[model samples]
Target: MHQRNISTRLKRRRAGDPMREFDALPPELRRWLAEASLPWSPRSARRIWRQGLKTGGVDEALRRLESAEVATLKRDRLAQL
Candidate 1:
């Protein structure tokens, strides 16, 4: 519950500003966000920034992290099979 409140406050405070959100997150999450964004070209990254204006950028980043984790798990499982 306490952690949830902290996350909520962080989201409310940062809103659409992904850089601020990146700064506020713990090191691991910040690293993940950076890695996920790294594949895009500058123009594509700018488009992401504009899109994030409507959807909370941090939320999108977290989703990206989740996606990467799921993909890794799937790959590992397939290798075992």
Candidate 2:
């Protein structure tokens, strides 16, 4: 058997049906997700969306998603240094 490469993070640990979860998201959120910089789990994205909805609405949710993606990118770049 071939040796496996070391892992940097966890992968594919889904507890529920990811497709179903994704299908339940708002259409606008789904569109935004298509252009997102990172692989965002449906549950986490929904949590942020709900938070933004509470604070404002759909536009606010999109802003929150963008803000989150930018922050994650910055952290990833710093880790690579």
Candidate 3:
């Protein structure tokens, strides 16, 4: 079994994207990502992180916004159908 540091795990999850890319993030960003109930793979956390960054640094906030947008789009399209 390969033991890896949490950061390495996180990096892999981000598809090996350099952490320097997210240097603008606060220290809490890593802790928040670690605590989030995402799938065990680093890839899942990376996806959340990417989305969170896109939505301005709050993972849950970004998820909610994305979910709302998706739901709204689905509803609109269904209505058009």
> lDDT winner among the candidates?
2
Q: What is the lDDT of residue 80 in candidate 2?
A: 67
lDDT of 3 by residue, 1-81 (tens): 322222212212334445553454455555544443332343444465566677676756457534643464455557667
Q: List the candidates' TM-scores in order.
A: 0.35, 0.80, 0.30
Span of ten consecutive residues with least summed lDDT in model 3 = 2-11
Model 1 lDDT on a 0 to 1 scale:
0.45
Best by TM-score: 2
Which pairs of residues clash in candidate 3, taking residues 3 or more apart in a chain or in different chains? 13-42, 13-43
Off by over 4 Å in 3: 1-57
Q: Would you list the clashing residue pairs of candidate 2?
A: none
Model 2 scores worst on lDDT over the 10 consecutive residues at 1-10
- Residue-pair clashes per prediction, in order, are 0, 0, 2
- For residue 66, what is the lDDT in candidate 1? 54
lDDT of 1 by residue, 1-81 (tens): 111111111112223656554565556454544555223223333444445435766667456545554564455557667
Q: Model 2, range 14-68, lDDT digits (tens) per residue?
A: 6688789999999998887766756677888899999999999998988998898
**Ranking 2 against 3 by TM-score, winner:** 2
